[model samples]
Target: MNIEKRVAELVDEKIAEINRPDVFLVSAKLHSNGKLIILIDGDKGVGIDECVQISRYVGFKLEEEDVIKTAYNLEVSSPGIDTPLVQPRQYTKNIGRNLSIKMADGSKREGTLRDATEDAVIIEEKIKEKGKKAEIVESTIPLEQISETKVLISFK
Candidate 1:
């Protein structure tokens, strides 16, 4: 009885019932303290109303099925901006945004995400020579080589 996995399936069923193609599940985790956390996201974004709807629907289904015999707290929300991107759709939606990527080999890269594909991502990196002007170069990184990628926030 993998509670986390079961919760994820229930959330997916609710998402299908709601018919919001843009909205998708990011993660469903059940902590040792009886806390069930569900993270959802959308291609554009997710609103509080959508989170509420998912929470209500999933909570109802969980109660009806007696999935968790013990008392538990259910929390449903979107992953924060600081959270690293986990899904291909997340990367696709973030095209044109700057990203700070950490490679699996322990190197790091910062660039503007130009495009995202099933197997790789193209990013525009700024190359600077000590005495020369900065040059923009496009780099292609395979998805398997990336360990984590976070969207960079710009003030201007």
Candidate 2:
């Protein structure tokens, strides 16, 4: 199997042993330089201790299996806030947060996430018209129509 696939399997095994269903594997990659990068996320959030425990578990498993004979590096961590949301569960957790979505047709929409269903998400946006009071409009966007969605962080 390819390195990436093998690493993914190892990650899955370790996560299963950890017994935290909320903690899930986002992505795993094995670099040509013998570096393994694993991204994990949780419904609430991933802590540094969780990352360290997973890293130790996977690292020990790999070493015992002789997966890497030479010096190798392993890193397990959460996908940062700047990372785009990929899973439906991820969207569900972000309800009430602002999101910037780029549609497949290249249009962009910024709104506060109101709700998420299996196939779509409801975003509430404020619209203002000339000589009219501003009102809130909710748009339901199918997940298929969105090319990318990123959580927007506001200082205020």
Candidate 3:
């Protein structure tokens, strides 16, 4: 079995044991030189304490099981704000945030994420016309047609 898959399985088991069903595994990668990276997400957001807890638990389990005979480094954390939204839950959690989305047709749109469903996301975009007041228009884009969606951070 793949090392990353096995690590994910162990992490899932530990997460269940801790009664943190809200936490879900986002990605797991076991790189050369014995570096294991695991990204997790929560319904709301992930906290550093939660990540540390999961990391300690997973590290202990892996060591106890002798999964890695050699020395290894484990890092568990959330996929930060800069990461693109890949899961439906991620879209739902990001409601009301600005998002820059790239469509499969190579078109891009920037808007406030209003709502998200299993099949599509509704975004409220402002339309600016020359010498005219800005108009807010809501558009729904199917998930299948979206190439990528990243949350836009505003310092203001």
- Write model 3 residue lDDT over 1-156, tens digit each, in one string: 567888889889878887888888888888888889999999977888878888998888887888877777899999988998888888998899999999999999999999999889999999899999999999999999999999999999
All candidates' lDDT scores? Answer: 0.92, 0.87, 0.90
Candidate with maximal lDDT? 1
Candidate 1 per-residue lDDT, tens place, 46-88, comes to 8998889989988998899898988999999999999999888
The TM-score values for the models, in the order shown, are 0.91, 0.82, 0.83
C-alpha root-mean-square deviation, each candidate: 1.6, 2.5, 2.5
Worst-scoring 10-residue span by lDDT in model 3 = 63-72
Candidate 3, residue 66: CA error in Å? Answer: 4.0
Number of backbone-clashing residue pairs for each candidate, in the order shown: 0, 0, 0
Looking at candidate 1, what is the lDDT of residue 45?
92
**Number of the predicted model whose TM-score against the real structure is largest:** 1
- 1 or 2, greater by lDDT: 1
What is the lDDT ranking, best to worst?
A: 1, 3, 2
Question: What lDDT score goes with residue 3 in model 2?
Answer: 62
> Candidate 2 local accuracy as lDDT?
0.87
As a whole number from 0 to 100, the lDDT of residue 116 in candidate 1 is: 98
